[model samples]
Target: MQEKIIDDKILEHMTLENVFKIINDNIFPLLNEKEKDFCRELQEFCIELHPKIDKNQDVYVLFPELGKRGYMQRINLWRDFMPYGMKSEILLATHLSCLDSQLELARLASGILCGNPTFQHGETDEILKVQDELMEGSKIGCIGITEPNRGSDAVNMTSTCRKSDDGSHVIYNAEKVFTTNGPKADYFATYAVYNQANPRGTMVQAMVSRDFKGQLITNRLKIPYVDRVHIAHTIMNEVEIPVNYILGDNGKGYTNLFDGLVPERLGIMGSGLGICWATLAYAIIYTNLRQQFGQNIINFQGVGFSLGDLLARTSSATALAFQAATSYDDNILFAEHPSKEAEKWIAGVSSQGKYLVSKLSADLTYTVQQQMGGISVTDNTDVQELSSTSYIEEVIGGARNIQLLIIQNALRRYSKLILS
Candidate 1:
């Protein structure tokens, strides 16, 4: 094949379009005729859902069924439209978009209300089946991992899990704080310190369904800009799950947790990339339109330079995210141990992407808002919402500081590898 060299400006435009096409093309082809029709329905529903994203106000109206029926319908539609593997890819993309939506809402709602809570019920096989069903309908599911005292240090969890005398059931007791979708989740993936007869280890994963005898107490709190979702402080008082309800091998819950983390990080990176793209698009339009002196504001060296920098960073971040996704997919296909190098690169790139894109997003939004002057502050203006939500891109998934930690860890590992 001949070497092709594309100009920087053309490459930038192509990259932007390509990222969106990746999502649209992957998602659209998977649908059959009926599923395509269902997708239209979902698109309509999503349009309605978008406005309600300002706060938790619309979740009840939008997610009334709150069962497998709704989620499964959507998941089925998605799967039917996309290839099997592509379904998962597109699902991740949809979730990234949803997280961006949620993060936008959080920005508007923060300080006006607290974050949304996870629903109180635990995860069960039945619930998982239901969730699988509902996932076809809905792309998002919330699980509570953080407790009051054990935020980052999940291994030091104080929650206790004890087996019944005959080992027929297990009782769990713990308090959970800051459970996202806490008051609204269909089911919860809960963790506790399980004490078995042999006491092989600490920690276990349990599925808790909403119907379980647990409480979803929405603690009243104020967030800024938007109304809060039903975030709660939860008490799991003697909740019993059948012994078989364990998500993985007994005493091996930590392994499962670790396994899940890579995907979770990838999901976060995807969201960050979306935010970066949105911010870039916003800046491009604003800079081209806003007039300062006799020419468009983009004519100024400072403004043009900033836009150029942001554009480059956004493109790079997106490429990193795509590469990570591809690497993850390949690793799974080959049943190979995840490439330590790839993982490290992903961790580093994702962390940098999160940081750069987050900062760039905020800067671009604020600058664009400044270009609009006072109108940017008005609640009714689209830019106003965009500006308010920009800060949240940094905080979601992992905070900027956390990303820095990940980058440092990756660097240390890379250096050790070089020396060894």
Candidate 2:
């Protein structure tokens, strides 16, 4: 096999279509025709829905009868892809590109991967009948894990879960912060520390309803650039749910919860890749068409270098992300009790992929925006909106500090991989 390196001028000269085809050929060959077509529709739909991402209230315009639901339900991508297992990670990134933020992907994954009753096994679950209502887009869902004071340290949580007198149900109480879809989610994959006898406890995750007595979103806040999507903090005050509602109720709920994290991180990787690809595309077009000094700006070494740098970072991020995804698909997807070494290695790859992509997104977008000059800041410029939103991507999955923490943890837990 002859290897063709995509250098600065090579990428600069190539058409966007050719670039994407290369991406398909190498990184995402697993994407089938049906999934490709769905991505096209989603991209076209989002463009049509809010052609100009900024200064548009269209994102807030809900489907007439769907309550708070947006176009995700109208398209039915979740229902079509949720049950597929490993492939859902790839499709999720495709989905996030059209959608504004990683929050939506994480929220949907929380429901589809974690909240879905069938995630535990092959048996039929009555909960499936209840969540079937979600297929239509009438309901929104969220996953609650991180508290305001503690994010990385989730195991030593203060939240508590206690069994009722007859053991028919458990009471869940926690102040879950940075919860995506928190304000509007009708169902939540919530977690609390169990073992009332001890002040400190291990994790216990559950699926809780919105109508529970003490359930409330409490406050609403907007994340910059993607302000149209709601982000909120929530509190569960002694919320009670039937024991059956518990997800991964076994003593090892934390282990089960981890099965869903891969998809969320992969989804963020997809979003970052999309942002850089778009930024690189815009930079290429602008430099080619926008004349300076009687020649195109792309001819200049400095401008070309910036574009090349963005291209290099974006491509690297894609490679890392795809490697992690494919590794999971092939090695970890069906493996039960994967060795600690295998788990640690996968975690390292995932963290590195996510961190590099997120940091690259923020850097790439900002550099391209600067290259475009002041005009790039105008509200109508797609580059400006994308650049601004790319900044938000830095903290979407995890804050940069937390990303560093993940990297450090990976090194400590899997020194063999790092030292190799």
Candidate 3:
């Protein structure tokens, strides 16, 4: 059967024309008629002014935005206006990645996974202040789970948080590496082992304020592309915040930390989706323009088949990512104790979805570059951004190996459920 003619609208070469179509047709229409105008306005602003792709910026300039307050408020305005749905998630993520968006937002997305304004225990006010600052784009945020010894191995992490003698404060002492948005982050939803509490030395999640002294934050990991999104090393020398800074409760820190996995990965997946779209689009245009053997290179079976495979992968990833996002959006996930059923579903998608999408995106970007051959390798083309950034994401939130382990654990749980 022939595919619908409308599906071909996105195939227009090297343009945002198709992106506008998808947002209008597949995504925005899902909203009420009242929102159509908002979608229209957003499409206009994004097409002309999305900063990531259109702007050439240095890390120094970008980092300041994190310190500037009220920036996230503007971003959050749209986020709040949009109804929560898989379509909304997909559209926002896909669009953000297209423009090399404010990378700090991704970090905030991860921190939010811990708990947001409506969810945090007792410290809702502080979280709200930080969150408000983050949404306003003045204050940056980071998820401080990874340590120097065990990256993403949250279970075996070594940092510790101890209550002060007066029981009024939580003191943190540790060093963390690969802290995304760290140098600029005003607050870190950090995970550390809880000392002098039940289940002694149990890992707990807390909010570490940058305003507090006795902390070191530096841009130690200097890579090529993502410096604009600073990944720094953080050294906490008796960094202290009130016990209220603790997210959720002390012993349940890990569980609170777990809440973010699905959303965080979904956000990352969206960025990957946008990159895949751009990479594939660019390759399509490039191959058609460049000729070989008296015809455009796109006519060759080798090139054509590769492109077809990439399309298949991108489509499959879109389906999987949306399904994952929907699974998460179904539940508010604010309860101090989440149900096992929710945990199972969230675990399944966040781990497996992130692994599959990031890997596929990396592969697709690589294939697109190969079609262009030589120039793809040089920094001259945007393909370099897709190529390098995808690699960073593969290891970003969690490594491929860690994701595989989570997937394995989730499968094990599923098998027991089936047998029972």
Question: Which parts of model 3 have CA positions greater than 4 angstroms off?
Answer: 1-13, 18-42, 51-56, 59-80, 85-87, 101-123, 196-201, 331-343, 414-420
RMSD of each: 9.7, 7.4, 6.5
Residue by residue across 1-420, what tens digits does model 3's lDDT show?
122221233233445655456434544434456446645654665566433443345333433342332222221222344443444555555654655533433533433432242244434677666655555455566777777887765667777777789988878887788877777667777777775344333666777787875664655577665656666788887888786676745667766666556567766777777777767766776677677789988999999999989877887787777666655555533335556786667667777878888898789888888887765665444566667778887887689998998888767877878988
Evaluate model 3: give its TM-score. Answer: 0.82
After TM-score superposition, what is the CA distance of residue 222 in candidate 3 from its true location, in Å? 1.9
Where is model 1 more than 4 Å wrong at Cα?
Answer: 1-56, 59-100, 103-128, 137-140, 195-200, 214-221, 225-229, 292-294, 333-360, 414-419
Please give the RMSD of candidate 2 to the true structure. Answer: 7.4
> Residues 31-119, candidate 1, lDDT per residue (tens digit)?
45644454354444444444444442444333433222232221122233332231233233333343334442322121001111111
Residue 246 in model 1: lDDT: 60
List clashing residue pairs in candidate 2: none
* TM-score of each predicted structure versus truth: 0.70, 0.78, 0.82
Comparing 1 with 2 on TM-score, the higher-scoring candidate is 2
lDDT computed for candidate 1: 0.50
Candidate 3 lDDT: 0.63
Clashes of each: 46, 0, 14
Q: Cα lDDT of all candidates, in order? A: 0.50, 0.60, 0.63
